[model samples]
Target: MLTLTWRRGDGRCAFLAGMLALLCYISPASAEDGYDLWLRYAPVGSSKVEGYRSALGNVVAPDRTPTQRVVREELRRGLAGLLGSEPRFRASPAGDAALVLGTPASSPWLAPLRHELEGVGEEGYLLRWTRLDGRDALVIAAHRDIGVLYGVFHLLRLVQAGVSLDGLDVSEVPRIKLRLLNHWDNLDGYVERGYAGGSLWDWHTLPGWEDPRYTDYARANASLGINGTVLNNVNANALSFSPAYLRKAAALADVFRPYGVRVYLSARFSAPMELGGLATADPLDPDVRQWWREKAREIYALIPDFGGFLVKANSEGQPGPQDYGRTHADGANVLADALAPHGGVVMWRAFVYAHDVPEDRAKQAYNEFVGLDGAFRDNVVVQVKNGPIDFQPREPFHPLFGAMPRTPLMLEFQITKEYLGFATHLVYLGPLYEEVLRADTHARGAGSTVARVVDGSLESHALSGIAGVANIGDDRTWSGSHFDQANWYAFGRLAWNPYQSARDIAAEWVAMTFSPAQEVVRPVVDMMMASRETAVDYMTPLGLHHVIARGHHYGPGPWVDGGPRADWTSVYYHRADRDGIGFDRTASGSDAVSQYAADVAREFNDVERVPEPLLLWFHHVRWDRRLRSGRPLWDELVHRYTRGVRNVEAMQVTWRRLEGRVDAPRHRQVAAFLRIQRDEAQWWRDASVAYFQSINGLPLPAGEAPPPHPLAYYLSLQFPYAPGDGR
Candidate 1:
């Protein structure tokens, strides 16, 4: 019954009007282009609208601070779109079902609940359906304005999900200190291993003209509790450190500040020599350290609350301390010292290997960092990939995870489907992330999961963090495909609480993105749940890793060899010949198994004790070796390859049934993508079988057909212009 007695922010009203106009003109068939992402804020079904409309018809919120203004405007936008009517704003509670949102310091009525707010940290929030001033209301209270904003998003999510608002008492706190997105976008607007269209950061036009899309990007990330973003490629580009680009980055930082998202830059280690007029870029040199300190000061002056650097030093030809014969800890410590005064931290990467072949490429990172366990500064976190190897279709947990008890290691997951199927495949990475997070590292005693290590619960470290190599781009859907957005969403949710179920996350995303109807939600979530397994089955079945075609990594390449480094070739990894396939990391081979805890190492070394899923990862067996399935190793391998392609077929069939259920545009795009996936999966199965057959000289398993083409034919087929491929 109450209406706004005061004016809204002039800038906010204009922005909303323009955005609404844009939405009005979007064609129905283009709905799945994904510009709206999970924040579509579409109208709820008639059946559920009555109760929600009554309960949330009016809001009692004050817009004093920037964050507070964002919270109020978001409520207006979301409620108007979802409930099909603009909610009235009141200075005080006027109706029995009005909404109340504020920090304890701002609201005298919420002062008594300050004790309750104390439980949730600075980034957490509390939402309760309670009575205020004798009128029943849904109260969203937090310790900080940003927390209040997060609470607002949560309330809108409930409406979007068609869930009941009755007795809603929810409290959420982020388990990790830093939940960040590492964007591998370069200065030239191209992204490394990025399947999405183009870079989101338009540096040429930034610090002068602000794009409206930037605000939308911030909102989407904020809605999912993502708090930080490193805005350039890890492959160091010194040009990004120039004054002009700093201003550009500062412009982005300003847009993201109110949403609790801090901006960090991927500081190229050789920037001193490249941009600072210095000769030797050594961490041990005082002159080199001073140059970095001055650079840090300049960056902090431009963006006061700028999150610190993400360094991928001395790896893959990127300059680092190793060039100066210094350890990773030394490089990280110097930067950490400079940033310490500004309350910043350095994220030093641990995806290291000698350019020359070591005993095994997988052992290099663990060998390098484990020795300097406690040498790193307290503020320096070692950012490590989820798997020991590069972002393959499937890989075992990185050995460095539990090895560094003295240092905090942040889990870095690739959200982009570089090796998976690149924008065209319907692969959900939720299960992949879940698999890594839930894996038992057995570091301390029983329940020492990789999740515990990342959250700092295992080592009792105060600083904990997780980073996802962002799949976000300038594409209409944000990510290249409609489904890939789920990976970004899943990463944020898991980074907030590693223990959350991936299936549950997919369910929530399905309901909010497609429709709240159970008919739509159930089947879509079911497809997502099985997607990653399907990808692993088809692309790299039975513990296979990194066998994609050379250069672009486009297709099957089990026969690929003669690369500059042996580790870069598929033959080095698969080791397929008269013997069976798989890398042997057990004691007799690379001895990578010894990097893990005693119990884990023992299990990995014993082929019988190892899980069959990873049979090929840790052991190299003969073709005739018998598996627990009572089948020969070669037959089991073939069965897995066939199973993978069959799963893709099943997914295609499942998606086809939803022709009329989902929006025509997104539905059409997804259907097309599913078709592509099925074809590609068949290609992978056939190509892999053919290559292995040439080496093993064995007959195809029973009921298996010979590949349609010879190995030469498949090898000659090339994708010279793949989307994410480097020229």
Candidate 2:
């Protein structure tokens, strides 16, 4: 990976050392796919290489346990990749800078410092410099072997980020108890809303041939401290619960177990009827309850550490307890009861809306769930989407966040860009995730941010979690686009610490993925920080949402109507007309703002107090109404659409300037994708302006370009084979 030239008593070697030191972290310009994600431990420069080699020259970790075995292997792999040499394995600390790793039980040297491990908890670790056997060594101690594994990854990440390890005294404990990935992948290798290639799990060869890629997947997730993974689509198939498929899942569990990643499955609610020989699958039925109990026992028998199930019941034509005329609590309690014995959980989804469209679709989930606040079993966590509606480019925080304080609510975020130009458009989701997490719900009073609710700080609940819909696939890059990997990385970081700054996470990702040089990190992070808002400005600025094409949800479709359900159409959300634009959700229209806490409802109901970005979401205003920008609503909308397209143009220019600073293959791919994004941004702006202008009969603002063709030209576009829409 690196060339070294040594000359005995020669000045030529000194000259080469100076040049190498000046280069400081040479970018691995060789061709590389993003398969490595953020764990690419490229060789360091001459300046720091010697120090790192001395510090990590030997390992003193025990390999008796499975987790300990993996920890030793990971250190060997990481050290070899970064220092260009494999570290020596020693039974005891001997070198001046050996890495001593173990719990008090595993290594007797850590037993004396047991009191220092007070707040680190079971999964947390303590890393500090200490004297071992009268020699200077870095100690990575924890309460358990899994914590030791996490500590190893943490140390490797710091090395990759070029951090100094001299005074290393750090303690890390995950803020959320369940950091998980929900894969919307089906058994047939087709992904529902997946933008990457096929599903990661090849079902045909599983249970026997354990692919090495599965091990790599665990390594990547473990590096980020993500502990759990739900291994199938929420639109579940009952056959997955059959004996054949359960064995397949058990095989995967064994592979992930050593890396601290426990596998969970998306349970079909009607599995008793489909997989078992039961007549009815009612949650209240004694027969159905017993069936689930037996199923849980069967699962635990194969995979002792099975993480339990994620159920998406009674939504989007899926079966649930409602089909049996019961509440959601009734549906979830049965599964929770079964899994509680094995120390598992039931993550029941709250993305539900009735077949009969309500006055506001945004209010349905809050209304359905708020009534059953304290009714659910303790092992059941109600999973909620970040926004009230679907994962649009932008939307207000869901009102249900603070409503169900009595129940454990796990925040669910979609990492896949189903809405914001899937995989092609360079939209970093860190800003979007940060915005919603920072929004205050005022459940108790002030300082009641959504992040508090998710991390169980406000509610003081024992179980806390945050899940992201996985963007991973069988593609070589993992995520289809290299930049999309940032979303997955950011989600895991935020899950580890809810209050961390998203911009800081972006910088960390950039430094590890590309060159650690400020020249590359600064511009890439700046572009990422601004990319989300740029897409929102062009796609759904000023809180306009669900304005994408039907079914596929690819491009502009504000004219869409006549769907099976009104909630499925773009017209239902925006409700733009010649008289006025935007939905009226205040008391005058749907009264949907009433779902929030009294203070938040008041702010959302009043036109003057509401955040200007969400003005259209709450109150319908006339085109001539003035905005905070001192322009009329019509003019502001036009300005935002144009601004979005301009931002994409600027991004393209930014990427062009970073050509040689990044690897040639990845750089070329990003540039080509940015070009695609620029064209699509133009399409979104032109198509939206043309359609809305036809309703209001307004002339174009000065210097704004008109649509290239008539409105029909934009409307005539069709995408029968869009990548993610597996249906």
Candidate 3:
């Protein structure tokens, strides 16, 4: 087990005492403290205040735009808390110790560096600690106010991370132009696939009284360089466009504006008839186009910087242009045209699957989208889910990543633990995000990574984006579990720079959110790093995906079948039979592997060459097939499941060692969750092995524990009202 010891007068003890004092003094009545997130610039202890005070002594912002005003205010607020004194605001960099914050247009002193900043783009910024007029100053220069806002957060992060500000020359430009957060929140408080409690936006309480949580939400997004948020669920409600609801959305837009976050709404394609009282909502109809134009004008009048509409048309029974014999592009173009004059873009989701059962579900998205390549308008972005299927615990990166070079594609990742054990499971999603981002698409060549496609580096598309379905809620800790917060943090960091490693991100987050002490940080990060794989091993190892209960996706359900739709059941995905186990995505069967690039298809198509991690996803091997590791396929599968359970047991041991390292409330919360995770892990291993072994006619390994109950009992388990199902 991991161990943590704190001696008197040591840094760990000092930091612990400081945290205790802050917790005692800080009243709970402040701004739904849950919303502030890491951006909370609460007072820091005296010992660490001197360096920040000396470095960031004064602020000099020249621009007076609303966004610029927000940048200035944030600097002042953050400095006051960290340095214990509000820095002086200067008109220019005339003072010896001033910090100049502005775009090149606002600050003439940065005119000479315009050449250097030319390639950085409108959203990029340059921060330097160079001398100005013989005075030591920090200059944050960008091409736009929003970029300056991002720079301010970056500067503050450096201070928080304890980096030396001297001789700094940091210039950063976002690879993706549109960094967005997709909330699966409905008009009602329910959030689909959301593990955290109900939605953060209290729709019942609106325009009249703006929640301070809204402002704090914006602050958190700004701190992570996330600039856009889609306010409603992809399974959209037309009522969001009602005049009353528009006012509520406008109120949120006002709060987020200061933090450089522009609000985007999920639009129901049939809103023309549902809300506008039109005879038809067809995209080809002239009246439908006119209705959208009028609606766009109405929405923009209330919120000028409105990012645009996120549409989930013709998927999962949602109405769309297809109902009227129009293509996906036809639906998006109509909306894009309406928002074009106002500089808005339509985010058209490519998560569509025909209601008709297909030979292979994984190939549906790629086939549909590849045909529509270059058919979309310049302002329309195709949003593709990280994996083709609904947020499974483990999935190969979607084939759509490299198939459509002409169309700008945005990655949609789920931060919520829909398939991974929900709020109670200690599954850190950093590695999951990294795995997808680092996947080699091989679209252009060997170097064609999914990160390049997402960031617009591969295709050179004008607009690029990466969005995470938020896990945020009314929970005091923001995310339901304390460690779950890292998923949110990891998503933002990856969205900003997809090249960042998950391990590094975890280390940084652990240091900031908890303690930076080596003993505490090291063990905590190790647990986090192993957490996701452990969940995968115990839940659905060897490329076996979507084996959860039918409705709530709670416990094991390998016997689950006969759902309203075949695709919704666990048996439909795994396809295990007495003959053998695993789906056949190879050419001999579904040929789903052909959807990938030529090289990827070649690798996946061959049984011998297919990666062991994805072996079951592509081919059905005999139970006794010999693995490269010399274990029979059945034995290896059981071993993986048992290893997963053991890993969770180890994590429990690791966490127990840190009893005094974290606060009593958070420590106990995590301990309780770990206990739940261990129980569930065992449940998963037993249930899965029991059901699969029944099909393969195999016995349990000599030392492995037999399943606790009969296969019927595990299959009979039910949870109709699980949270996040949005029933």
Candidate 4:
């Protein structure tokens, strides 16, 4: 209900408005394009404006450091936008309601609370309502400048979410140490698996032309507490380390430094051979080792606080130590030894699969890593994907989460909708992330959760982290679609605290991104909470994984086969036949379930005991096998696929109801995208049913509609120009 007003005192409001618009990337028109993301500080409702103004009327914070300067600017910009008035900036806490922000060293008044600050560590903050100058004051104090910035963002987030700041009390420290976004962006500005437009990093215009967009990118990541960003594709080019590109990276590092975001690169393991013309790129070779060591030094000299390398070696034809008859440890250690001198850690990816077929692709990473648990150097962290297989719509947590105790493991999640609808479907990944994190690994007794393993609590390891494959691009919306932006936001929030609720995160995102009204927030949150399951039901119900089309992964391709490798085809995963439709990973089959802890393995091994959602993942039962729904397996599968399509329809309806409540532009875009999702859901459902029925020859369930097209019709569909298919 609060309306915008111009302050007539000394023309400061006019000056402040221009500054806020420039800093926040505000456009001339009022229409939203989602560039601002959740940081858009629209004015609060009338009921809460007065309370927020009272709590944040005057700000007292230092600008001695770059981080401190950004904090003050952010507070000024955010407060002016949220309260519709520029709050007074004071040298010290004096007003009846003042917001004080600084570290104990910067603000002497905060020294008395040093004991309370002890638990916050170096990058944590403490916020509380206290009496200063015998008046009400809210202090955002930290042990470091970066923490103060994080605290300021947190306070602004609360304000944007329409929370009461009367008794504000918050103490937050990130559970994970290195929350990073891995950009699969090549030097040519092409993003692999990126549904958004071209890469955000215009490599052609870098170092000399530092895009203001780069600073905004850092701001968004800093708001989410993501402190690191891997700027290139995992399929790295050696030129990224070239002097020209390194200078380009250095410029980005300088821009991101103030926001506490350190730049990292996806280092090519064969860089010695490519860049330095070495005879052999073996990790054990003396020349190769020295080359990497010197390379690390050169990089650090250019960018002192560089966060080190993310290596993807020996996976999908990438060169690695394995090519020279060496192990993953050898490959990681050489880089780790080089970076250890500069206090940098190497994040070595564990997503490896051999050229020859294995018993099960899901079992490969665990088989490769579990044996070398303690072989890794102290500066090496094995980055494992959330699931053992590729980023399936629904997958059991990777077995290696608890298997490797000695070595620190970083959970890698794909924020891009690679397997989902790729920016077209409204699939909120918070629930998926939450499900994987909360999964009980049962490694050390009864309740060894994956979250504990990633946070280093279960193993008491010194290092812990999580990484997200970024969906960001040069598109105006940043993530190709408005809804896709939530995944990036959710990943950062979950990385900060893995134990938080997905529904709560969804609610917070809905409030910040859209309206905070219960009508808008409630339905939107409900849709988001159910979206992942809805996608699973239509795309790959009952633990069905990797059933998408051959190349671009667009539509259903249950009949797809005859690829270069059997594992690359859809048939290798689902394994549907006349008898059944599911992969059997039990003792009689591949025994992939055995990789898990005893308790988890036992449940997954038994079809009756395993969760029904994952029925097909472990057991290949008969077509007539009775499911929990009292219907046979085939009927239940059809029911689930149909149910998924219906749920998408329901979501379309839900979104339609918010036409006027939400902004016209975003609302129209979401509605169109939802229509596409609904249509695609139908396509996925019908095509899958058509293909499966050809194998099973089963009659359609009662009230179930038959596919309008035949299996061959669906099979003949081709997409030669699908987006994000760059190899």
**Model 3 worst lDDT window (10 residues):** 27-36
Each model's lDDT comes to: 0.89, 0.91, 0.86, 0.92
TM-score of each: 0.96, 0.95, 0.93, 0.96
By TM-score, the candidates rank as 4, 1, 2, 3
Q: Which candidate is the best by lDDT?
A: 4
Model 4 Cα lDDT, one tens digit per residue, 1-727: 9566677885778887887778665453344889999999998998999988887888888888899999998998998999998878778875454788898899876777778899998899998898777777899999999999999999999999898887778999999899999999999989999999999998888888999999999999999899999999999999999989999999999999999999999999999999999999999999999999999999999999999999999998899999999999999999999999999999999999887988799999999999999999998999999998999999999999999999999999999999999999999999999999999999998779999999999999989999999999998899999999999999999999999999999999999999888999999999999999999999999999999998888888888899678988888988999999889999889999899999999999999999998888888889999988899999999999999999999999999999889887789899999999999999999999999999999999999999999888888888998888856
Judge candidate 4 against the unseen true structure and give its global Cα lDDT, from 0 to 1. Answer: 0.92
lDDT of 2 by residue, 187-250 (tens): 9999988989999999999898999999999999888889999999999999888889999999
Total clashing pairs in model 2 = 0
Ranking by lDDT: 4, 2, 1, 3
Error of 4 at 78 (Å): 0.4
Provide the lDDT at 695 for model 2: 89
The residue ranges of model 3 lying beyond 4 angstroms of the native Cα positions read 1-36, 40-48, 91-95, 108-112
> Residue 549 in model 2: shift from native, Å?
0.5
How many Å off is the CA of 6 in candidate 4?
A: 29
Q: What's the CA RMSD of model 3 in angstroms?
A: 6.5
Any idea how many clashes model 3 has? 0
Q: Which pairs of residues clash in candidate 1, taking residues 3 or more apart in a chain or in different chains?
A: none
Off by over 4 Å in 4: 1-30, 95-97
Deviating ranges (above 4 Å) for candidate 1: 1-26, 94-97
